[model samples]
Target: MRYCSIPCRVVGALLFGSVAANAFAQVGQQSVPLSADDNAEVEHVWRFAQETESRSSLPRAVDANWIENARLGTLKLSGCAAALVSADGLAVTSATCLRSLENWIRPDDSVFVAGTLLEERKLPGLTARQLVEIREFARIEEASEDLETGFEAELIAADDSSTFWEYVWRTYGDVRLVVIPPADVTDFGNEEGVYPRYAIDFALFRVYDGQALPLETESYFAWNDRSPYVRERLFATAFDANTPFTVITLSDTFSYNGTISPPHTTLYGMLDQYYSHGATGAWELTEDWLSGIKENDLATALNFSVVGECAQTGAGLINVDMEILGIAFDNANTEEGTRCVVMSTSGILALLRTVLKAQGVADELAEQALP
Candidate 1:
């Protein structure tokens, strides 16, 4: 995604008083101390956003406790989704998450079981090992319409979730995903016909062992695809209070047009992951409903920035009450800027459905769907 920093003052007017309470009020006065469900989902989304921002802005050390408690899974062999696809022993996540591994592995390498937890943790440091690249069924070019239409990728694993986490911890365990979407699809397209199509904002993939890590819990934002585009106020909190909470007023949708073809391919592949910010966390309005309000401006605004010095990879972008918003995909330090990107809940849901369908597990989940 394109990186440009605007003077905070340019957004000061729109951001003024755009806190969670204010956004909630604008939506409607429900109740303070939101219901249990609301609290979990909302808080999850809020913290995820803050954690992502914090990683971008500073070199905050990863807490061991936080690492131990995060959910662990892998992406489907090609697409950017992460979840425990089966109890019988398969884990799913995104291919991009494992791209580094794909680059190094040799074809003749053999897969071996690492005896679950303790042994698996030591797998990465072993010297007598060879990296193996598993062949996937799809390619990026095949999935896109042109140089711009986004492609879908997936990752498949034979190991269970526990093994997944163990592998992550041993190799690269600190990461997060955040989801953001353009207020309107038109803002993402260009005359070349390259545009941002609607998809999940972000998803998380963490490593684990036999025990399932508690997934980030919070009250989730309800999907409102039909809601008209408006300069709505939104709020997000940092995982650490030392960091300032951000309140954004999405004034107007900005357009981004680019090619998705090798070096550019990685950049193109990441556009969805890159621009997946805004409303990734919990949203609220004040009780009076008059605070944190902004109108769509003609200037068309985009909120994008990197937290200096922080490695926020894999930190959860949560809403208030701690529901999972998405995971942090980039570390600011690596690029001399915040490298975080997010996918939305809807994007995650789609991946979940797709992976489950591929694994033939969706039928079971469908039977237990909540009313």
Candidate 2:
């Protein structure tokens, strides 16, 4: 979640915007197409997109505060989608990102989180906690209170069993990790039809804000308590290429929900959406809409990454953030594409426990996995 540095498409554009209303009506909700239907659901869809797109796309407008909060979920990837889990700066993204950087992030060559062929540095002390800043070939003195001190990180945890992940870890050294998680898949296949069915593709990071402290904000996603079931209503944030807000169904039409279920995984995302680079990380959020979460003590998390063709993977997945690795499904009914996949929420939590244990950060993780 690496392409040769195109690591992968961060977020697959969920089937919202454009003709999404029509689709939603067919399966989950009623239609709100611009041509007709003046109702709450339709208006919510229109307004969410209009207001969200207004934040960055349109500078001078009724920019909503919620948009700023939504930004908490958006993390900068080498073009992939990533999510901020802790206000103190812990984030997560698909481990599949490494598959794209198998060539660049190696010990023998210069290492970098290459976003767009940007300037890079070589840090020998770059461990899992963070990236070290080397100046003039010397590790710079870290300020005692500098929260932004670390840039590089170590593989906190990953499916250690996956050969692709282990090989990349040995080579490029896990570029975006502040820590690692064990994994079973790494670049097994990034193609829309060749998604990695066996890979546990999630990874975590501890980020430092510009002020050198944890991000100074009150907006961060809280992990949901249980796994999402099939056909749940999903709401997500989108990248520049899509409408700011996307509303879709969990997609129970296919056999995806049962694909990677287990102690290794559960709860995958399935949807009919568009796949593109700008859409990556678009859905790396909790919930921006009240409609998605019902009034209950344990409301299902509407936040998650949709799987699609990652430019990084050269491919497809409808990732639900850390929940499921995501897989893309295509059929003749392709309005754009047939389906998108995601990881299971419970699966991510299960693996995260292993990640924390391996990183020796188990004691602090209860706080870390929270917003």
Candidate 3:
């Protein structure tokens, strides 16, 4: 019901399409009363997947691919999520991760993202920087034979379609990560039934070697060339709100094409994992531009889809199958279960390839065997 063992710091959402339109909206403008947990005092904060006091006990806890995925690395945005896409240091994530003008108010706003948006979000002098730095994609042992070369990445381009964005890591990195969420956070909204898979929340990056060259490692996620079918199992991973690594799964084949009521709403997808939080939206859209209140911002992200159409865009996406995170396999069907929704892999890949083409590196994509 709540989004965390940790507290929720949901903020007001500002939704605008064309800068000329200047369409503004707010989420739950009515002040939500903060519970003791919501308003808890200062304490330590370690991001997801980063070292933590409790990490030592979980040794052999995650797969080596996870480390590779980690090695592929991640980009730190004030309020967004991202991951390494290639060994040469390409990365991918939702194009709208940082689309929120509200997030650019910080002093470091000039750090690089979108240039034009910066000007729009701020004063005349503000220019956006697309490139950002990525730290370790994975951890190498102090004594490991492979040396670690810390590198910085550059943001080359983002597709105009907004379905996916692309960046290149100085070097490349990639690894298939099998995730097991255990007790975690899914934020797919409490007791809500609609699935939000409209953001087209995906991106691509090229990871280079430490020397800032093309990556040649065997550790990349193959393009999964084959189209996804209903009722198939897909493993998906997402970096946590902070240092945690999260993987969620779809228990069975779910659909929305013409099945659920309201024809356009009611997507059938659920996280086969456990999460403490409910969903958050990039923009809450509906038949009317205002019905969506914090759902994923497909309107802004893709510049398509009517506002409020993807009204439950918690963390910008909900998709695909198999519950892998935790050792706690009770399957109680308790409310604690993660209720999520995701777009079909076929669809995700189609959008991704478009970004790849724009980046001129479609060949860099791994070869997927037809299923």
**TM per candidate:** 0.30, 0.44, 0.36
Evaluation by TM-score, superior candidate among 1 and 2: 2
Better of 2 and 3 by TM-score: 2
Off by over 4 Å in 3: 1-78, 100-196, 207-219, 227-235, 241-243, 253-338, 343-345, 351-359, 366-371
- The 10 consecutive residues of candidate 2 with the worst lDDT sum are 18-27
lDDT winner between candidates 2 and 3: 2
Q: Per-residue alpha-carbon lDDT of model 3 for 1-371, expressed as tens digits?
A: 22232233322111111111000111112222222122111111122235444232222222222333332333443344443333443344432332332233344331222212112122222111222222222222311243335433322211232221122233223211111111111122322234333333343333333343444543333333232222222223332342223322223223334543111122122211111212324222222212221232222212111111121221222111111111110111222333344333233333233321221333333432111
Give one digit per residue, the lDDT tens place, for model 2 in 68-185.
3443344434434455555455555555543343342444432112221122222233222211221111122321222223343222111231212100111122223443332212
Winning model by lDDT: 2
Error of 1 at 35 (Å): 25
Task: Return the candidate ranking by lDDT, descending.
Answer: 2, 3, 1
| TM-score computed on alpha carbons, candidate 2 | 0.44
Comparison by TM-score, 1 against 3, better one: 3
Q: How accurate is candidate 3 locally (lDDT)?
A: 0.26
